[model samples]
Target chain A: MKSAFRQSMAWLHTWVGLLLSWVLFFIFLTGTVGYFDDELDDWMTPQTPTFSATADDSLPVLEQFLATKGADLKNYSVSFPVDRTQPFLTISYRDADSKRQRIKLNPYTGEELTPRATAGGQTLYRMHYRLRYMPTKIAYYIVGVATMFMFLALITGVVIHKKIFKEFFTFRRGKKPTAWLDGHNLMSVMSLPFHFMITFTGFLLLLYTLMPLIMNAHYGEGKEGRDAFFKEYFSRTNVKASGIHEPSLELKTLLERADAEMAGKPLAWLSVANVGDKNSIFEAGSIHKNLSDSRDKWVFDANNGELIKVQIGHESSKSFYYVLRSLHEGLFASTPLRWLYFLTGLLGTGMIASGMVLWTVKRRTKAIKSGGGSFGYRFTEGLNLACLLGLPAGIAMYLIANRVLPLELSERTLWEVNSLFITFSAFILVAVAKAIAKKADSAWVSLTFLTGFLYVLVPIVNAITTEHNLLLSVLNQNWVFVGVDAVCITVAMACFVLGNYLNKIFNVKVNQQEHSAGPDFKRGHAS
Target chain B: MIILLSMLIMFHALLFLLLAMPKYNKQISVFPKRDKKLESNFRHVGYVLLVICIALLIVDNGVGVGIALVCGLLTFLGSLVSVMFTFNQTNTAASLIWLPKKIFGVISSSSAYFYLVGYGVLVTSFTLFF
Candidate 1:
């Protein structure tokens, strides 16, 4: 009975892991990249200077802008140029049409600065959960479903590892699927805690979108009901306008009063509602100070500067949500902690990538034994190779395009995004073409080389087109540019070593010789 | 600085745990021959080193951040040891112990005493730095 149960679990693990592993791979890889989103944002928007202007200096410009374009804005917020996250003072509000609007302002001169446009790191971060060219609601459901399967995979994976403790330090790099299995198992077991936490938090993040019926039943249906639910869900408050025109206390005064309450945390952003009304309320928030708690908020009366409410901690259920959110986003991490998050994220991503390859490689053996694989096997391997290498290559192209593309080009941001998807799709197409021609082995080796080449090309193009070259960045102690260049070169070297390894194992001539000798299991990797 | 030290200790601890397994005992062959007493000693020592690593991190950074760092570094160091075994990089693993022994001038030439001295130095460094 025990053996049967284990067998069933193994079956379940394989299928569940195989079915969503592609989408999961994409989700994991993009989510891992999201860790350095801020640093990448700095690198991409090079023309934007690092602003160190004080809040007092930037407030008058903010007030002047608010008086003009913000006349009709009932609820607007100002983000101070306090730190690396958003290094320039900015004001954001929803327009009459209810679409969100934001503008950047020069901290010292008060002039509007329009930096060179690009689809920055936020887009890539968003692409992980929101996906691309699709409605967010739909993407949420897709990512939500994937997260559920991932959680299941982790559970079944743990159950199936009979030698869990004994094999904790085991990874034998021998033969095709054996090595791939070791890579997969080592990654999975080593980071099991992080994998579980991230997957659970990721699913929790999408819970409202996934099961809207529970909220809908209580609050009614459609957009308004969802908004109402969310307001209550997040413990948000609203103030009624007195309709009497009275200019509230200066923004500067309100912030100073709230300063002591913030407990040394940097100012994140603040909002004022009812603007000039007598009963206007203001809200100030601080950036995250720890892992479990996100930014804290202090709500006050804009007219009197009296603290109305302070949300330092929450009740149990809400606190649980906050902790999950904090762990998922990891905004509270220090430099070393952030690297830990990143490396663990890469481990999780590698787990999924290696699992997919193992599944395909195992099947390839059987398909060969049966006298050549069906088109499905060929296509799957090709797609696996495409994703494992092509996505990184596409990302390298995205970085290069940011530097090399014409700055004056119209819709430049959109083109930058397009370049990534186009390169990725072209690689897929080429892999598919070779799969159809029965030369998938050669395609894998060549594409691996090409991906490495593209990554190596990134820093070269950056040096040619930008003044923030690696050498200058290092000399100036501009760690952002230096980090980006160093990581690119590191990734390129890894790819080259991997390409060389695959080249040795999946050489076309060797594969062709094996083809003449009947179906074999010697080809390395997905080939 | 503290994190790197903690990670180094954690990595060595995991390596000891790996070497304790009889399969790994033969596979790595870091010692002249695997003694039952030595493997048992390694097993206990590995757990002890892990505890010391956690304590060092806690002393360096307060509990809240310390625990978080320990959790992350565990996955990282575990993977490092696993990869070492995967690629049969046992010589590289042995050299880590060998260098520490030579540097500290082992009163005893055993890997166990060498690690103890290494830990002593690490704790001293942590104390001085903090």
Candidate 2:
């Protein structure tokens, strides 16, 4: 009975893991990359200047932008590039037509900069949650379901792999084909806290959508109710324009006081809303220093700089929620901590990728005994490689697209995104084709090599087209751009090493023959 | 710098803890046999080192961020150790295990070393956590 129970659990773990592994893989990989979205943004937009300018230095540029361009606008928000996430003087206003005009200016020079449009890191970051080519609501539901499964998988994994005590036993032999479990459990226990934390926090992030009925019941029904609930729960301020023209006090005075109020919070974004109106308000919000609170905000009356509202601290429940939200986003993470997040996230990705790979590994013997695998088997084989290697290859192509695509082209952003999907789809086809041809090992080896090649091209193409080439970036001390180049090269090395290992796995001759016996060897040498 | 320091300390802490386990001793330990007294000593030292790591981090960073960072670093280093074990990379483990083995052999034979670490952990934790 004990054995049966364990068997059932093992079976459940496998099937459940396999079911959503592809989607989860995509989510995990993309979300991992999202940690460095700001850095990627700097890399993608090579026009961004590197300087050590403070908020005080950028304040004049902000003042000038508002004095000239924002003079006639009734709703404008300006923020100095005080934070690493957004390193520019961002002035956004509505024109006479009420069409929003947002511009990035050099904080020191006060000159407007027009960066060529490409689907930057923000898109990739958004894609992790919102996903692409689908309605956001549906995507939320899908991701929420995936998160739930991920949570379940973690729990089930723990339950089944209760032999964590065995991890200490170096001499133990697997009485069954539980190499996957042994590996999975060891890796899981190593980072189980993180896996659980990230997943649970992620699930909580979509709590409103996941369990909308609770809010609808309390706050009243429909979208209006949801909006109302969010406004109160999140403590968002809504100020409508009164249309009465009031000469507003200079923002400098308010900001000085606001800075005093904040003390020494690292990430502060100040916005002036209902601009030029009687109800105009200046809001300065700082994400907490140690990440205890998400934000401590101060609101001031635009006319006289009198403090209107001070939003600080929440109830215990709300405070807990704030901490969880901060942990989920990791907004307060230093560069070192951020790298830890990325590496751990990659570990999570590896865990999922390995499980997905093992699903096929465990089945290969049976499939071969039965001649060829079923459609589902072949499809999964294809999708596994597609998710693991193909997606990254596509991402490499996306970066390459940014560098190589015509800068003046209309709909460049769309094309850049299209390039990613196009590359991804091509590899999907290659994988599926290779799987169908019963050369899955060759497919893995070749795709891994191709992924490495594309990654190598990422830095190369950047060097060819952009001023932020590796040499100049290093010389200029532009670490973000240099990091991008360095990471691509590192990724290329990783791919080459993995490809070499995989080529040896089946002793697949397509790559191995060329590697060991030169390119003269033919396809006939493959097993 | 705190991250690197924490990871390094934690690595030693984990290594000591692993060395205490007899099964791992059978496979990975250079001594090739477990000394029951030494195992007890190593285990105590391991737990104390971990306590010191967490306390040091909390003191340095703060209560909330420090704990959170510890959580992250714990997972990262734990995964790394897991990888080493998984690959059965005894060479790497042996290299890491060398200093700790030498130190533990000398230190574990004497209870004073354990007492000293325990006292340090207590003082640091008391000063900060209080």
Candidate 3:
């Protein structure tokens, strides 16, 4: 009975892992990259200078800049540069034509910095959950299902590996299936806590999409129901706008009062609503420093700077959700801890990639014996190649496109995203064509080499296009740009080494086949 | 500073666990016999040290950040050890059994009196300098 149960678990682990492994790989890789989303944003916008300015210091400069707009501003927001990730103050407001506009400014000088147009890391971060070419709600449901499958796979994997701890110390290299299995096992077991926590928290974050029945049951149907659910469930109090126009108080004064109320906790953002009205409201939100506590926002009368209400702490259920969301986002993480998070996320990506490869490797022998195997085997192998190698190449191409594409090009950000898909689709086509020709090994080697070469070219392109090359960045102690360059070079070297190794393996296989079946068979089989 | 110290403690504990494995008994010359009691004792001490390190981390950085940091550090250390052992066959479990013996040999060849007097001098100098 016990053996039967173990066998069932092993079966479950394999199928669940294989079914969503590709999407999970994309999710994991993008999410891993998303850990440095802000840093990537900084690197992409090279025109923005790095400077440290307190909220109090930047608020006045921001106000003066807004006053110069010469429009009856309605509904505007000023985001202070509270951390290194965001070094420039950002003002977002509706222009005279009622078109929304955003501009970054050097807080000290209040001089506008026109950074080059790019999709930035925000696109990559959103793609992890929202995905592309699909409605966001549909994408969230898909990603949520994949996350739940990941949790299932982790649990079943643990059940099947009876000697989990013992296997942690064992890694046999230079062996066919054993090597891959050992790698998958080692990565999974070594970072089991992180994998489990990330998966569980990721699922929880998308619970609204996964299980909308609760909201439906509580508030009935349609958009009004959803809005009502959020208003009540989140304990939000809405004040209606009064049409009486009045001049608002200085934002600096309101910020000071909010800061005093929150005991000097740094305010992350301020939202002003009912602008140009008598009942205008200003909400100042304090950044949450720990996952256990919820963020606090103080609402004040915009005209008088009088405190209206303070929203701090969450109820029981909301607190639980907040903590889970915070853990997954890592917003409170310090430098060392954040690096650790990134490393662990990389390991999770490796675990998923290795598992996908191991699936192909485990069946290769059978497939070869059966004269190129079944349709499923060939398709899986092709996809494995396309996803594992093609995605990185596509990402590298995307980064390169950001530098090479014309800044004044129409819909530049859209084209940048399009370039990624186009490059990725091209690689997928190559993989599929090579798989059909029975030259999968060649496809892997070429794609990996291209990926390595593209990554290597990114820094060179950056140097030609911008002044923040590796040397200059290092001299100025700009670690964000320096780190991006260093990581790119290191990844390039790794890819080159991998490509070389794959070439050697392919050569050996060819030689063996020739020796066994003579020249005639080799000629017929050669693509 | 505390994170670094915790990482160091975990690394040494993992090293101790690796050393205590029965598979390395043949490779290591200093500990020829399979001392089960010694291995058990080392395991206990390692766990205790890990617990203490975790408590210290939590006290220093609060619950949410502390747990995340510890997990991250642990994963980092595990990956480092796995990579090191995988690439260098000489550092694998089947080797490095004589590491302790070699270090002990260097210290044992000196006179006990001289070693004690050197230790005393080092301690006194460290105290005075600080």
Candidate 4:
């Protein structure tokens, strides 16, 4: 009975892991990159000077600056720099033309800093779950389905590995099928907790989108019902604007009071609703620690400095939701813990990539015997190569383009994103062509080399175009740029080593073939 | 510092468990005569040290961060051990016991024994100093 169950699980694991492996790979890669999203954002926008100022000190400067912009600036928000990654105060307001405008200010001096336009790391973070170039709802549904398959794959994978504990310490390198299998097992088993938690929490993050029936049933039909449901659920109070003009208390005082109420947590953002009205409400939200949204917030009556509502903790159900969401996001993770998250995320990416390769490796002998494999076999092999090497190459090209592309080019951000896809598609084309020509091994080796070379160029290009090169960044203690450059070089070296290893293996196989079948063996084999 | 120390303890504990296996014992040839009793005791000691390491990690870093760090460290150190075992199969176990083998000949001959004692001293010093 146990054997039968294990067989069934093995079958399920194989199919589930193979089917959505590419999407899962993409998600894992982008999500791993998302761990350093803020640092990446800082590096991408070089014009924004790194400032060291407290939110308490910056609040008055931000308010004084906004006050000079006139009373017409309504429905605006001011966000203070919470950490080193975000060193500038952000003020976003609806202009007189009713178009939203946001500007980053030198937190200490309130001088506007115009950073060069780029899609930024937020796009990469968003792409992990929402994807790009589609209705976000559809992307959510697709990602949720992939997340579900991932959960099933993890469970079934565990169920099938009978010697899970024994295999935890077993990894045999330089072997063909077993080596790949060992890698898959090693990464999966070693980081099983992270895999399970990340997958489950990822699914939970899209719970409402995936299972909307509960929301529909509870809120009833129509937009009004949905708004009402959100208002109650999110603890959003609807305070209408009283037309009578009144002076409001300074933002600094309100921020101090909110900080005290939240036990000294730094204020992240402040929202002034019903501005220039008698009943204006000032909402001060603390930095996100262990929740999707800032859980600790204080609302004050703007007209008088009277405290209105203090929201420190959540109800049990909300707490569960927030905790799970935060776990997936890792917004509260410290520097070392965040690095751990990033590393494990990379391991998960490797696990998925190796699983994809293992499928090809397992079938290589049978496929070769069956006259160069079926269409599905060739297609999947090509796709595995394209995705594994091509995606990283594309990301490197994107970073390089960010540095080399003309700063004042129109739609610069769009071109940066387009460069990624263009490079990715080009690599895919090369892989497909090589697969068709029966040079898949050579293709893999060359593409790996190219990827590494391109990655190596990222730092060089940055050094040429940006003043914040590795040396300058180190000298200035600009760790974000320094870290990015160092990681790029390390990844480049790894790729180069892999490429050299593959080249050696390919040469060994070729030499063996020639020895077995004479000098013209290659021509005959090609035929 | 605490997390790194705890990871070292956990990695050694896992290495001990691996060494305790009869197959690994024969492969390394550290023990000419394998004792079943010693193997079982080594396994028990490994588990106990692992528990202690995990407790220290959790106390130092909170539950969420601690568990994540341990998993990350396990993945990293496990890979290192696998590579060392693959390339330097014979010397890997001997290298861990270099100090003890030089001092106490027969007592430190068994890699499993070395791991057990190493776990004890490391855990004791970590607890005392850290």
Give Cα distance to truth, residue A523, candidate 4, Å: 18
- After superposition, the stretches of candidate 3 with alpha carbons farther than 4 Å from their true spots are A69-71, A95-99, A235-237, A244-248, A274-278, A303-305, A518-527, B24-32, B89-130
Candidate 3 chain A, poorest ten consecutive residues by summed lDDT? A66-75
Cα lDDT tens digits for candidate 2, A1-527: 97788788888888888899888888988998999998888788896574445678888887777778657666777656666776777777788898998888898889987777878888887888898899999999999999988887888787776566545322222322366645555556666777898999999989888888889999999889998998999888788988898887777887887877766654357777776679999888774466675677888898878889887777788888888888877887888888888887887887898789778888987876676688789778988987888889988998999888888999999888889989999999999888887778889999999999999999889988888789998998889989989999999999999899877766753455458655335444653
Query: For candidate 3, what is the TM-score?
Result: 0.90
DockQ of each: 0.59, 0.47, 0.55, 0.49
- What are the Cα lDDT values of the candidates? 0.82, 0.78, 0.80, 0.81
Q: TM-score for every candidate vs. truth?
A: 0.90, 0.89, 0.90, 0.92
Q: What would the per-residue lDDT of candidate 3 be over residues A461-495, giving only the tens digit for each residue?
A: 98999999999999999998898899899999999
Clashing pairs in 4: none
Q: Cα RMSD to native, each candidate?
A: 4.6, 5.0, 4.9, 3.4
Better of 3 and 4 by TM-score: 4
How are the candidates ranked when ordered by DockQ, highest leading?
1, 3, 4, 2
Clashes of each: 0, 0, 1, 0
User: What are the candidates' interface root-mean-square deviations?
Assistant: 1.6, 3.6, 1.3, 2.6
In candidate 4 the C-alpha lDDT for residue A209 amounts to 78
Off by more than 4 A, model 2: A50-52, A69-71, A165-181, A243-246, A274-278, A508-527, B85-130
Off by over 4 Å in 1: A52-75, A93-101, A369-371, A508-527, B28-32, B55-67, B86-90, B99-129
